[model samples]
Target: MSEIHGSYDMGPSVLSPENVAPKTAEVQDLERILRGEISAVEAYKQVLEKYSTYENANSLRRILVEHEKAVDFWKKQLRSQESFVEESSGPWGTVVETFVGAAKLFGDGPTLRALKEGEEHGLNEYQDLIENGNVNFESESFIKTICLDQQRLHIATLDSLIMMNKV
Candidate 1:
């Protein structure tokens, strides 16, 4: 119901130089992961749009929609929390943008493979972030479960696509 800001503003104090100091590598990784989630959703959308006429268009669309849902969930949570920090240098966005451009140039086969690889990288990143003590972010178990599923599904999807000569 409320308008979403990129991050919650508890007060100006939170933005003070000392309070907003650079984050540790682990926290930076969490920020990167969050950015990657958004990027993945964007990449998936680009893929669905690019391959709307492909044989498995509907499946692609389903995956893209699901990813969009996940992106929104994380964005909403990050915006709601006061302590959420934005990265000074956003590597995830660059990575996603490059992948999307590649997807646009290549056909569905290679694009999907690239996406699967990205998802695999994301899975490892999320696992590492979850294990990092500096981040200490607590999300719903459902989110964790969904992240795990995305990782596994990406691997399976890549394997099936390769086997079927779809990608």
Candidate 2:
């Protein structure tokens, strides 16, 4: 075998080891958000099933669809980056489930209020991510779009709560 020559100068590193740590952290953050969306979807379904005959049941179903869409979008984004999306929502999910269970005891109005609060919490998380300025351009764009959708969902939930109060 021939002896090696001078040190090979590789071109610029696209994803150097130093660059990876921040990216990995960002991915983990996104995965956390994705898990939250998954829990939200499940929570909405549980509420829908619990109050199938409630006057605003159909509206709840529509909101569930929106949450499902958010889940799908997050999944697509994570997959695009070859990131592993966490399947479970972790401890916070358990807390959400417990809260939802308690809210059910109070009937449809309380359930809707709980859901509205959840959406607001999710919106705040996204906003925080955007404010942190650590995400890549693609992730930033996706988060902004998600934030807008979440804002709409929050408003819709508020409207539903108002109407429920009227009834």
**Backbone clash count, each prediction separately:** 0, 0
Q: Could you tell me the TM-score of candidate 1?
A: 0.69
Check candidate 2 and list the clashing pairs.
Answer: none
RMSD vs true structure, all candidates: 8.3, 6.6
TM-score of each: 0.69, 0.76
Q: Can you write out model 2's per-residue Cα lDDT over 1-167, one digit (the tens) per residue?
A: 89998999776555443433345667777877888888788888888777778676776777778778878877777767766556667788888898988988987667777787888888888888888876788778877776667656666766666576621
lDDT of each: 0.64, 0.74
Top-lDDT structure, candidate number: 2
- RMSD of candidate 1 to the truth, in angstroms, is 8.3
Per-residue error for 49 in candidate 1, Å, reads: 2.0
